[model samples]
Target: MSKRNRASVSLPKGVHRVISRGREYFYYQIGRGTDHEGDRIKLPNDPRSPEFWQAVRQAQGLIGQVPADTIGALIDAYETAWPGLPRKLTEGTREQYRRSLKVVRTAWGDLQASSLKPSHVQALIEKLGANTPGSANNVLDALRAMCRWACGPRELLDRDPTQGVVHFDRGEGHRPWTPEQLSYADEHLTGMLRRAYVLARYTGQRASDIIRLGWTDVDDGGFGLRQKKTGVRPWCPIFPELDTEMSKWERRPGPFLLQDNGRPFTTNQLWKVFNAAREETPLDGAVWHGLRANAAIRLRQANHSIAAICDMLGMSPPIVER
Candidate 1:
């Protein structure tokens, strides 16, 4: 039982320290003149091991750095990251950015602004593509915008990783509902949602704008409201047919056509109820938003002037062409 036991050891020096193990350990420094802290750390076995602790040591260099030390800084870094951009966008566009932030936070929200790398951007765009093809390009656009905001106005990064990303389908811009489809949808739907759909077809307002519509906007068989998306104003005399429908709803509180729990509807929440309502209707391929596009296409088909369409739809002329 008295067999001798021995251990092999070797040490290296240079900005390094020694550590000991067992019941006790001793401190030693290669340079006596230096007043650095004691180096009696417990020696890790297999210094060449794949699990070596050197990685932790390497990270120690970044201990005292700030967000300015990396390119991954927060949204506040830019005085106007997308200042006028956000305002120019409609409430719907702002909501999209809010959603985009969720994905960014999940990816690298904690990293400093200066440390964001092209690789990180590429990875994020790839993931966006995988998760939501239709929205993937949009996410890429948002991320690129954030990076531009973070990178300063001088175009800091060598190449924007998201620059060339293509949409999942090039032709998915708009899919308008035909009159036959609208008729079928209306016949299938009843109550407020049907009327809402009718309004969407005529007004061409985005669901975001449509939900906020109220009785106050209507007057003498016509309605007037400021379009949120384009900041344009359009006043349309309600068609005689629609006028009859509005006359019946004089008892509701406030001005909005759609309501949630008796309050005005929000864009995010209305879709669920809209979808549920659609299931009962004969409408297929008719998304809540499709109503807006359908209305636009119909307006165009009716030879409504481009400017009139833009004002009524709250979109720019360029958007209408797109």
Candidate 2:
């Protein structure tokens, strides 16, 4: 907070100390150019710590004109506005926002929110498309939600650059794993993979619910889970096989069926294992999520009504059709 501490602090090239109206931070060219100022910005936050500043300075030593304190204020404002939003988005929705913000940070970390344009939003959508169609849509949806929250009530985006983006046409819901694939998964998947996959295949529950399933949820032969994705609380008759599987593992393993390095498996980590199993499984197109699809398909095949499968999966009628 003193001039000595500030002076001893070396900044990236083009970055300088900026102190305005009792606030302090730093700034730099978010966009590259000569004679053009305010093209870039930054602030003192987790990402822009002293170590990062040193890296930037080493890369392009002592840049002129950009003020560091100003950048810090911008950083503060951007981060500050995020949590201030009023909406109580579901946990799944919050995760979506977090993922979207990561894209924004990676793309425009140096720019102030005022500097964001339709093109920046468009480019973020494009980068997201490189992954999956669903992921791209998620990034767009999350960004639009955040912008709306920041700009004010009523869909504040005039252009909504991501609005017109077309996602890939997925199949009429995912195809369930074939019999051979199921057999292979049963045989090949070991430890927690076996437990997780079996629960998914049997209950048709989302990964969110499946990971959080506990003894308390299991009553008599049916289990109760409030599906986080859909906010649906449904009681599903536990598959007899599921009971056998549960008996095999230690209970109260503290919430999650799978543990990695003694920590409960996160959805992200589950996907990683799922991807690996997909590669190994002869069922070429089936995903880890396809286990749920498999259960749905099996229920339908065994003469369960549409409503029954929907209830089991905690999906709405329309979602079940999709």
TM-score of each: 0.64, 0.64
Q: Across residues 1-322, which tens digit of lDDT does each residue of candidate 2 receive?
A: 3544454443445666667786566665533555555445564433223234433443354555333322223333333344433444565666666776676656665555555677767776777677766777776776666555445343223334344555555547666788898888888888877888888888888777788887778767887877786567777888888878887777664664756677777787877777777774485677667777777777877898889888778776765666
lDDT tens per residue, model 1, 22-82: 3322223334357764443343333322122232233334354333322333432322223
**Model 2 stretches astray by more than 4 angstroms:** 1-86, 111-120, 153-173, 247-253, 256-263, 271-285
Please give the range of 10 consecutive residues that has the lowest summed lDDT in model 1. 1-10
For model 1, the superposed segments whose C-alpha errors exceed 4 Å read: 1-72, 76-91, 153-170, 178-180, 219-222, 228-232, 251-253, 258-260
lDDT of 1 at 217: 79
List the global CA lDDT of all models: 0.57, 0.64
Model 2 scores worst on lDDT over the 10 consecutive residues at: 68-77
Instruction: For candidate 2, give the lDDT.
Output: 0.64
